[model samples]
Each structure stands twice: as C-alpha cells, then as structure tokens.
Target: MPSSTPLHTPFCDLLGCRYPILQAGMGGVARAELVVAVAGAGGFGCLGMVRESPDLIRQQVDQVRALTSNPFAVNLIPSATDPDLFRAELDECVRLRIPVLMFFWDVVADAVARAKDAGCLVIHQVGSVEHAKRAEAAGADMIIAQGVEAGGHVHGMVSSLVLLPQVVDAVSIPVVGSGGFASGRSLVAALALGAHGIHCGTAFLATKESFAHDVHKQKILSATECDTIHTDAFAINWPPHSNVRVLKTEVTESIESQPYGHLPDKIPRRVVAEEQGRPIYWMSTDSPLKSMTGDLEKLAMYAGQVTGQITQIEDVQTVIHRIVAEAEATLQQLSNRS
Candidate 1:
C-alpha cells in the first residue's frame, strides 16, 4: 500500500466525519486519548460503552466533547440489558445532541427511536444480512458488517471478505466493512466490494493512545495470524458464544483441551494477578495492562486475522493518516491502469 488516496476522499456523511477510517470502539481499550487522537486526525473515533455505567458514559462523552469539537460517536452496547440500562445515557446524548450513535450487539426498536428523536445518527454493527435488514428497519442510518475475522466477539460465520459485499447489496443504507482490517489495501478491497468506510479494532489497539496494557501491544506486534486463536475462555464470565481472537498462550491451550461447554470452576488466578498490575504468563480478567501491555506472548492479546500484518507500534495519528493515504494510492493505481 502506498500513500496516494486524497486525505479526505472518503468522508462519512452518515456521521459527518471527515475521514472514512474509523478507530474501532473497543471496550476497556478505547479511551478518551484514543478517541480524540483519531478524531483529531480527521477520522471518527468511537468510545466503547459496554460495561460502563451511565455516569461513566456521560463523563466520557463530556471529556471527548471538551477535547475536540469534532463529531465523534459513542458505541453503545445494546445487548447488555434492557434499553432501560442505557436510558440515562441516551438522555445525555440527546442533551449533548451528539451526532453519531453506533450500536453493537442487540438493536432494540425503542433505542433507535430515542436516538432518532435526539437527531442522532444511528449506525448498527451486524454479522449477517439478516441483521443488516433488521437494523435498517429499526431505523439505522448505516450498518457495520463485522466479519468473523473480528477480534472480540464474532457474531456469524460470514467473513468480511464475503459478508461485506452481501450486506452491501442487502441494505439501502451505508455498509461499512470491519474484521481484520489493518492496511490500506484492505480498505481498498473493502470499498471495491461496496463498503462505504472501514471499521477497525486490532489496528488501533497497537497505537500509542490505546489504553491497552504495554504487554498486550507487544504480543500483537510479535504475533502472526497463526499465533492467534479464537476461544470461549473468556465467555465463562463474558458473553456466550463469546469468542476472543487472542495470541495463543498456555491459558488458551489449557482451555482448548477441556470438553465443550465445560467452564473452569474459577477464573485462572493469573487473571486476578494481571488485573492487580502483576505480569502473568496468561491473560486473566485481572490483567490491568489489558489495553496496551505489549506482552502478547503471555497476555490475551485480542486481534483479528490481520494480526499477521501488524509488525510495529506507531502513533495513532500516523496510523490513521497512513491507512487513508495507502488506500488512496492503491485505488488510484488500479484506476490508472484500468
């Protein structure tokens, strides 16, 4: 990939953002700095709102607002509870009059109406064409096609390579492709397949502003696609069918040897140690450096299949700018010969 696409060629009218390169909203990893940095760099940044209390969401929103007057989105976890859990946060969005609201997981009708009532743009992330249609009917202004290659929770067997084009045709609204996008060539491929923009998580996890633990970042940098594995190890406490794309480690190996549907009586003690700020050979819930630990060899370094493409750590702004430039150049090269 080369730097050739105009810096602002792909603008997201749905969210009124300048760049089509979105910093994927990652829970526990997405922080104010990461959001602001990407937004400041001309791309839209999303703050992951899963597990956040209403007050925390409001505070994050206010913090992002103060940092940049630019339009940023709040990635809402619609699957967590009834819409009631997010009612207060929804009210705040209405109060602040935020421009973009991207919902992941379950999309409830009332949630859409509330955001719409506030004049907020609604974007929904889905894994299948069925979900895409549902989101659109629920009043989504856009749909994010999250393929199986995605890092955290993979929703469907549909991969980005196949799912993007399918959802694009299925929906009248904008279709954004996600799942393992780490380079401009990937973005170019996505656009050619009918995607309007790109949604990325793992790429942003390696950036300077990411709140991930230092060890986590290192693991990603060191890993290849084969080094990563998808497992339900975290699902014991997290979401069912909960899959995480993590660098293969002792924990994953141990978990994989167990019978299906079996859960550990207790989370590995390493999880607590990691959370308490101690280093461990395996990632546990307790790994405080979960976001950017740079120690993927022993941590739950969540990533996509594209983890193979990432080899270095870069500043958030540089990463954003480079992706856009490379995408443009690749597209232009194709256009020139054609």
Candidate 2:
C-alpha cells in the first residue's frame, strides 16, 4: 500500500518529480517509451542516447514531449563513442532544449559549459569522490555516484554504501547514489547515507516498459545476488579495464576459459540477432536491444546484485509507488523506534 502522505525530499524538489527515484539512462535499453512512462508516473526518466543517432534522438525527444509535459533527461557517454558523432548528438540535444543532460565515464568541460549556456542542467556520474569534486568544479547541477555493484561498464571499485557518503561529503551539488539499488529499502538507506536520491538501472531494466528482451528481463527475475559476476571480458571491445556486472552465462564461461589477449577483436554482426538491415556494432559491450532477436543468450545480459530482489515484471507506476510507499513505512517505523 502506498503511504497516505507523499514522500518529499530535496531530490524530488530539484528534479520536480514526485519521487526521488531515477531510472538510469542505460545505453541500448532506455528508450522513449520507458522514459515517458517513468516521467508520467512522477519519477524522473532518462533516455540513454549514447548509442542513438542524432535523428533518432530528435524523434525520441519529440515522442517523449508528446507523451508527458514533465521534465526528463538524456544521458550520453561522451568518451565511449566517436567524437564527431557525439558532438552532433550534443548539438541536437541543445537544439531540442532538453531539460537535463547526464554525462558518464569522463567529463568534457567545454561541452558542459555549452549545455549550461543552452539552459540545460548538467548531471555527471562518477565513481570516486575526486571525480565528484571535479564534476562540481566543472559546473554540474548534480552528480551520480556509481559504485562497483552497478551493471554494465562500472566506473570504480567502491561499493555504493561506502561511495555515497564520500561523494556527499566531497561536493555541494546534490548527489545521487547508483549501483545495486532496486527497492524502497535501498532508497531509504541511500537517503540515510545523505544522498539526495537513488539511480536504479538493473531494476528498471526488468520493467514492462523497458526495451530489453523478454528473456533478459526474466534472467534478472530468476537471478540471485550470487549469480552476477564482475569482469572485464566484455570491455575488450570498449576501453580496457571497463568492468561490467552481468549474469553468469555460457558466453561468460567461454570468455573466462581463455586468456585476455586471446579474445576476439570484434564480435561479428551475424552473431547478433536483430531486425533485418539494422546496423549492429561489433562491440561485445552492447546490451541486448529490443530490436535484437538472435542468439540472445550470447549477448551481454547486464544486471546488478539487486536482481535477487526483483521477482516479477511490473509497470513503471507500480514500481515507483511501491518504492515510495515502502520507504514511507520504513521511515515511520524508524521514527517510532527512536
């Protein structure tokens, strides 16, 4: 049951959302429908635009605007893709007048300034306290402290429990705690740790509106905390040492059997099962997209340790309400105990 009283925090006020929960801008999976559903449900939604073209981004942005009038964000991994293409996407985001833009992996000061000048709020996701401070200095409106427990290309080695407080203490800007957050209990815990909000990826990936394949969502639902393994096997196609937390599969087993230097330079396009004529990249780091259809088990099925807590796929509204309601109850119980 949802609490009679709404849970309000600084993060809610800052993002103008009914709750402080943020659906992560997971590349390849966070699409327009997911973003609109989350935004419409009073939680902040972020569109993962890292792998999208400028034209697709424009279409998605327009689609989101048509669905909801609420504020939403677009996430870009500036350092992960081609520079010219990234610049084009950035220009499109500014041209579309996006309310918020999030950058992960590395921060570009000049690009940050340009987005700010265009009236877009900039949020940077970092893994360390030093990076949080650097984001603050670079004029970020907020920072997402991504811990080692996060799925897909994690940034640092610290756990969220330890990293959140360190980041909160380091920067004046509002800090969002990411990695392994799945439910209201964790949301309340993050708030207790001084985080302004929580950013959830693996949990959201299992939602009905997510673009992830059905098998992918079921994999998360059936997984336990111990089922996920962190390794750099998928990072061979991306930057070296870019570790990922994913469900252990035969593909991972095969990768583990070989020496790091023996891995293939690129995963052939034919190995991916996707829509006919759709452009598929050679990177093993790419998640299974909705358009993908073949060899689903062989692709990267990214998830977090929190997958153990997700038993079923629910609509975005139900997920948000349940978290808010549960957090409210927990907070009240704690208050009474004191």
Candidate 3:
C-alpha cells in the first residue's frame, strides 16, 4: 500500500520515491542490501560504485533489481576511477537499465551525455554554487549541494546552512542539500532553504542494514557533534591533500599533532586472523564494512556533525518513516500557526 503521508515534495515525485530522502553513496559502505532496503522503504538508495569492478557493479545492480522495482541510484567518483573502468561501469549501468546515475569529485561530460542518451537521470554532486551552475549547463537532471559538514571526502568549505541556498539560487535544476542532516527538522529546513530534498550519509551509517561494522555503528550512536574532526590526514590512502571528516580516533589525534605535509610516509596496516586462521591485512583508511574484520576501532570512522542526532540503530524503513512522519507533523503545526 502506498503511504498516505502528507510529506510530498517535487524531488520525491522526480525520483519516484515516497519521500525526498537520498542515501549518500558512501564508498565501500553503500552496498546492494542497503540500497534495496532504502529504496524499498520509499527513499532513494544509491550504490557506491567507486573502485568497484564492472562485474561487481553488474551483480549489485542485479541484486537490487531482484529485490525492488523502485528507482535507485549509482554513484561514481570520476576522479578516483580509472577512465576505462568508469566507461565499463557506465556501460553496464546503461545496459542494466538503471534509472539514476550520479557523479562526484569531477564532472564527466561524456558520461553525462551517454547516461542521458540511455534515458537515465543524471545527478551531479557539487560543493559550490559555481559547480552547481556547471552541472546544470552540463545537462544534469539534478544537483546535490554538499557542504563541508559532510562526512568522508568533503570537497567544499562552506556549511550546508550556507551553501544550500546559494546552490539553489545558482542552478535551474533541482538541488538537494547534503551534510549534517539526520532528522525530520533538518529535512524540513532543507525545503525551507529551497532544496527539493535532503541527502544524508552519517545518519544512514547508523542504520541496521548498513554494511558498516557493528563497532563503527556503535561509535556513531555514541558520538557527539564534537566527536568528528575534518582534516587531510587520511588523504594518503586515496587523493593526496584532500579533506575528510572522521571520528576522533587515536590515529586522527596523532595526525593532528603533526605539522602539515609531515605525516607518516607509510599507510598503517592491521593484521587479523580469519576463521580459518588466515591472516588478513587491513588498511586504516578503509571503511569498516561487514566484510572486513580487523582493528576497526583504529580505522577511519567517517561521520558527520549530525552524529549527535543518531542515538540508535534502526532499520531503513523505520528511519525513513519516522523522518517523514515527523516532518509532516511539523509542517502541519507550522501551517496551523500561520
């Protein structure tokens, strides 16, 4: 049965979802099951396809298709991807008839044209008004205005409260606000700020269906807004000198004590024995996905300033329904007051 919830927005209609909530394509974390769960719950779910093989992308997409007929998105970070591999992934997405394609870090005109030609909606994630305008001119279907408060690799320096309105004013296309959003109040605030929807990352990391390790989820639940620190410490694993937001772990503390460009030359690795007594080496910068078993506490625990709002771990459906229901009630109250 379709939800009778009064929380309706143009973004939801455009994406064919019941709510205007999009799961952030956190690399290595947004897997097939999480996407299926979010999409099935009436919110858009996106697969994080960065650094993934074409075959794995196909398998994940196929799994999502088998679970839900609803629309979902696939995110690709062009700057982090090999040109040929990105082309292959794009081709697979087109052949599989995926509905949405999202790009971050850098815009690829050819990929945008190809996805559009294949009848797919293209969303570009931007950190500034200029990038948002560029995305609009590049034939993007929509834009996600990501602020510096976002977890993981944040590309912009402005906060969501300041950037969303600017991007909305600068772009003719629909704009979604990301960074520091975890509640219905924040969703309503995004709409008030002229955003058609909200893009959330840290909040979803605490969800039961997320691929993040249990320890990481617990850390998210226990963390306060001040528990997160944004720095270029973990950039050595991916793009050098890039800024990232992660939990305040001992590793981060050590990095903070060092001068810029004077950090360790070697990537920290932890060895853990598998079920069969086979040892596996894990990188400290890798996301704490369930497939990984190691010193998760010492690795990067990417979370946003909204971590304070995420007090518990719930299923995707519950999370979506609660946010929508709260927003509807809040809107109703505001309307009555006026």
Q: Who wins the TM-score comparison?
A: 2
Give the per-residue lDDT of model 3 (tens digit) for 1-338. 13545666778778888888999998878988899999888899999988688898999999888898888999987776777887888888898888999898767777788889999999999888888887788899999999998998888899999999999998888999999887888899999999989999988888888888898899888889999887776643465656778888766777676513523255554563232353434323466778766566766789999998889999998998888888888898899999
Pairs with steric clashes in candidate 2: 273-293, 273-294
The models' CA-based lDDT, in order, is: 0.74, 0.84, 0.83
| lDDT tens digits by residue: candidate 2, 52-155 | 79998999999999888889899988777788988999999999999999999877788788889999998999989988888889899999999989887788
Candidate scoring better on TM-score of 1 and 2: 2
**Stretches of candidate 3 above 4 Å error?**
1-5, 258-285
Ranking under lDDT, best-scoring first?
2, 3, 1
Task: Order candidates by TM-score, high to low.
Answer: 2, 3, 1
Q: Candidate 2: which stretches are off by over 4 Å?
A: 1-6, 257-270, 279-283
Model 1 / residue 211 / CA error / Å: 0.8
Prediction 3 TM-score vs. true: 0.92
The TM-score between candidate 2 and the true structure equals 0.93
Per-model TM values vs. the true structure? 0.87, 0.93, 0.92
* 9 Cα displacement, candidate 3 (Å): 1.8
Better of 1 and 3 by TM-score: 3
